[model samples]
Target: MPLYVWLACGLYWMNGMATVVLGSVLPLAVQHLHTTYVFGSDLVFLQFVGYWIGVPLSSMAVRRTGYRGAIVASSAITALASAGFTAWPKPLPYLVCSLANGIGMALMQATVSTSLIEWFPARRAVIMSRTEAAFGLGCVLGPLFASACIAAGRWQVAFALVAAAAAALAVVGAFTPMAARDSREGPRDAHTDAIHLANRRDRALVLALFMLCVLIYVGLESCVNNFLPAVFVEHFGLPATTASVAVSAFWAAMVAGRMATGWIARKLPYRPYLILAALGTLCTTVVLAATRSVVLGYVECVWLGLFMSGIYVVTLVFANHAFPDLTGLVTRLVTFFAGLGGATLPYAFGWTLAKTGSQWADVALALFAAVLFGVVGWTGWVTKRKSRSPSERVHAAG
Candidate 1:
């Protein structure tokens, strides 16, 4: 019920909307910027590159300005960049603006992720799910906003709207009360965490597993979301409108799934729930790839979104609980690699399809699903082994 909780939700919503809105208005970007569509797409590549740059910048921002200040500053930067995108529609300036927007987006995600632990210690998993659900809701709305703007012959309005919302969020964040650096809620110091990791050899193993989980999960999810429309159009011979609807259905299911998972987290163990979700994702993806029926494809996408919804937020919550002292740093590391996956995986999927034929696409998805299962098993094993240790036993006793 704290103000920061609501602000975090708002931050996430804007972050989500900003990510896909550019793609939605890509046609306008190409026309106004006087660049080929192929070159215009480089804006996306540059944005992710900025995301990579923000990883280290966010750490420095937190060190210099604290979490609250970092969030405000990042939000302001996002607003400025968004407004600039509309102000200067030329390709060169647009690229710079997109890069700045990416930096702001990355910092916002990192700050909210680290802040959530202290903000909602007792129910971090549930709260994290809700935050991510807000993101899904933004994803669902962003296209609609862009479509409406384009329909009205004013696509630039979409960028202006994004800028206004981000600016408002920055102003609200500036006025909000927040925890200080010296607060008791502060995480363990770096030296103390290093000592604990040294004492427990498996800690490093657990962290490695977590990072791998993030990398694979992000890669798989990004590939599915970004390419599903193309798959529908090309393979099923569906209309573009129908393909778009399928994509919307996936995001809608994601929004519902996050809420459902948040409720499930209250009763079910995170591990079992994740395993169940993973199993469902594997089934749906295989079916999706194998089927040609539009109805079946739509159904599969819904189920796929439902299962995919829980993974990212849950992984983040687990990492925070596992390494509370290193949440900011660990989140930045995981998300930095996730950005790489976002940039690379779709290209990999396309390259594989082009080289080996489209049949290989399903194989790729299935392989990734198998990898997800393996990661889950590894996580469960690591958790069980840690539980058997004397330190864990003593902690359990307390």
Candidate 2:
């Protein structure tokens, strides 16, 4: 119920929204900026770099300067960067602004991610999942709104709108309180909590299992999310717009799935819920592989979104409980690679599809699904075996 928590949530939404919002309109931005589409996408590359480097740095800064300063600074920087993108159409300005925005976004995600873990530890899964769902909502809303601006040929106007919106977030965040980083919570118990969270019921096996599951989950989901438009174009011989709608469905399903996970996490522990989700994902992948219908592809996309909504967050939950104190460090490490996986997987999927056919992509999905099952099954067995022990978490990290 703290004001900083509210502010952090708002920033979380903006950062999440902005990152996804650009994906839909990157091609448009490139044309408008008088640069290669690859140049505009360089923004994403820079953003990834920022995310890779800036998150841990921001966490360290937050430790020293507090989230209030870091959050406000990041917001202002991002807003200004976005404003520049809107106002200045030249290539240099565009790349500069874009990379700055990337830096700001990375700092914002890292600082806020750590702040949230601290703010709502007792309900980490539900709270994180719900807040993240707002991000999923942003992924849809940002492009939807921007696409409208594009229809009017007002790309700058759209960037201006996002800029103004981000600036407003900065204002509100400036007024929010810094979270309690005080040690009245005690170093001993804090360290204890971190340990209890880190050591899984099954020692090192759970982390290994979770990471494998995540790698597969991320691989297939990213491939589909990244390439659905192209797939629809080739497979169904549809217009780009038609394929885009399917992409929208994927994101919307992701939002819905996150909401569902938040509700389910309240009822189930990490292991069972993920098992069911992975299993369901496996079934959907099977259906997708067997069918050649474009409609079925869309349906498969929805189910993929459903499972993915929780996959990363669930991994985060497992990580947090198993590694509380090192949460930021661990998050940056894992997410950096996950981001790498997501970025690269799509091209691989597309390349294979081009060489062979659309059917090969399903093999990738099914392979990913199989990986998830192996992960979930192994984790379940390990977790169950160790439930009777006095402590569940150990320091075995994957």
Candidate 3:
């Protein structure tokens, strides 16, 4: 493996930890800030709003700074904002810090993903799955760290650790070797041209379907992560510390699933893999909705995490393969929807949870999972239909 790949993994590991930092400590943070759950959700919303704003700007950042500079700058911003999160124990300041952290995370994520796709185009899916496994590893550890801090009545320390990690990544990004922009571009292939020549309507439909998948998948995952601890506490009467462990278990399953996906994706077609994963997610969400046992709750969390693990990464790889010429644009657009989903869903879930209950919230998540399954299935059918040889199409017509 290349040294840069290891650096990318390190960056992703930090990104994963930062991604769930707020969620892991949400209950304690809210109590410390003397705020409500709704306020916490609002902070989540603001952070992802920063993500929404940052995606397009990330492209500009890349253009101006190149990959290394963008990575370093984003890391520095994340480190600063994460530190700011605990500096003031007020609502407004925390909100501002959350938004800043979101922007930094979005910029770094987009830059790293685009670079990896370019750098390892031949092994895109496998490499992406591996890096995402690193992300899952981070998610698994983040809540455990937060849980320990919460147990010690030092939940704020989690943010400090995130800050320290991001700062280190900033230093590493500065010194890491990266391919120059002009040097990374590969010659266009016939498959790329074939995609360009395909029916415009079909192409648009495929992209739309994939984007919808990204949006729903991201939203559902974010909602679950942000609120699972609360759900475990309220619905199952679990202690706050115990609830945080549920989050870790969920991501531990995710790490396992992603590690398996790197190998499974090589044998299984992307379309079928996506369909199966989506279906698995829907099943788990439904089971989770119906189950009331605390034991079942933990089981469902792990199952849900395993099923949801590879949907986002595999979808991105599939879309990139479909529209090879538009990898960068597709990445940005997909990430933009991811931000949109992450921004809206959790806040909506929080509001719904406030108005209704965890049961209804679980129902909503199951519904979203069903929609994801449908979308993935539809995308598979469309792509398969489109991919048939002209003779096959003619034979079918005959």
Candidate 4:
């Protein structure tokens, strides 16, 4: 890996840090801002809207501006937005700030995903795993860090900290090697191909896999992360603090699982690896519905997290493999599905919980798992059939 890769990783770590902090602190923010819980979630909704909106276009910007430029732009935007959160006067300002952060994050995400996939070709899984592990670390630490910062009684200081981190990262990334890929030189994975979502070796399979992975991973993560605390409090008879612990363990286990996923995918193809992960998630989600024991229920949430991590990354990685010549294109398309999934499912899960018992959470999980299983199987089958014949592979890709 180049020094730039490491630097980009650092920037990405900090980038992810603020993203996690902002997302996790929504409830606290709502209280402090004197808004309803609806405002809290609307923040997530708006940010995701920005994210999904930028998914396709950011890759193009990276193509035009170069990877280093893309990263710098994303970092600057995110840092400024984080700082804006502190001084912004009202909910409208917060929403706009989040939207800006989301757009910058999407661009940065694409830049890093494109750059890192190329940096460690032989160790794709391990390298990507390490990157995701960093994201997990950010997710785990952001909430607690924000809490601590808030306790210090100056919330603006927290935003300022994120801004400083972003600016510093941007400086480092600007100096780092970008592995600049030119058209007609590097293969699909190396060039603007990551942006060409439609040109993978097995286009049909890629589409199906992308849809499945995004929906399943995002849905499950949002569902459990957002709503499970309430479930534990109500169904499992746990105190709010204990219930909160379940959410924490979920993220921690997700980080661990992502580490394991990267390690696992190195040797095994993502197809089966993702299948196993989804199956594991399905089993535990079912168990969550059945468990009455408070402690055991929280433990199941940990298992849920363990199974949740890396499934989406696997989708991105494998999609890159299918369209190695155009990873940027496919990565964006896949992530768009993933991001949309993340945005949409939490609402569905919340609705389910409100309308039915906590068992409804299991139902949602089951639906997500089922869709993913179907997509994976179909995509794998199509890819397998195409690989058997060079003409078929070429034709399918074309």
TM-score per prediction, in order, is: 0.83, 0.77, 0.95, 0.81
Give the per-residue lDDT digits (tens) of candidate 4, residues 1-398: 54665676576567557666664444456567897545645666677676786676677776798777888888888888888987873789998997887787777887787777765554556667767777776666655566566566554555777788888888877776666432232212211112223344447645665666676677566666555556665576654444545666777887898777755764676666767777787778777777778778768867877877877777777777767776556767766775687677766665566567667666776777666666666766655554445555578779
Worst 10-residue lDDT window for candidate 3 reads 188-197
Residue-level lDDT of model 1, residues 191-242, one tens digit each, is: 1111134345667788888888887887787666545555565577764434
Off by over 4 Å in 1: 25-43, 84-94, 149-157, 180-201, 238-242, 350-363, 391-398
For candidate 1, the TM-score is 0.83
Instruction: Output the lDDT of residue 264, model 3.
Output: 77
Q: Model 2: per-residue lDDT, tens digit, 1-398?
A: 45665666677667655665455555455556666434533555555555556666686778787877787778888899878877787777766776687678767876776666766666667667766787677665665666566567664565676687789988888776675543323111111112222244444565655556555665566565445555565567865445556667777888899988777776677767777888888888788778778878888878777876787777777666765566666666555555455444544665566566657766766776777777777766665555433433243321
Clashing pairs in 2: 197-321, 197-322, 198-322, 199-393, 199-394, 200-394
Tell me which of candidates 2 and 4 scores higher on TM-score: 4
Q: Count the backbone clashes (under 3 Å) in each candidate.
A: 0, 6, 0, 17
For candidate 3, write residues 31-127 as lDDT tens digits. 8778778897898899899898778878999899888888998899889988997677678889899899889988988888888887777667777
CA displacement after TM-score superposition, residue 210 of candidate 1 (Å):
0.2
User: Local distance difference test, per candidate?
Assistant: 0.73, 0.65, 0.84, 0.67
- Best by lDDT, which number? 3
Worst 10 residues of 2 by lDDT: 186-195
Q: For model 3, which pairs clash?
A: none
The true-versus-predicted C-alpha distance at residue 376 of model 1, in Å, is: 2.4
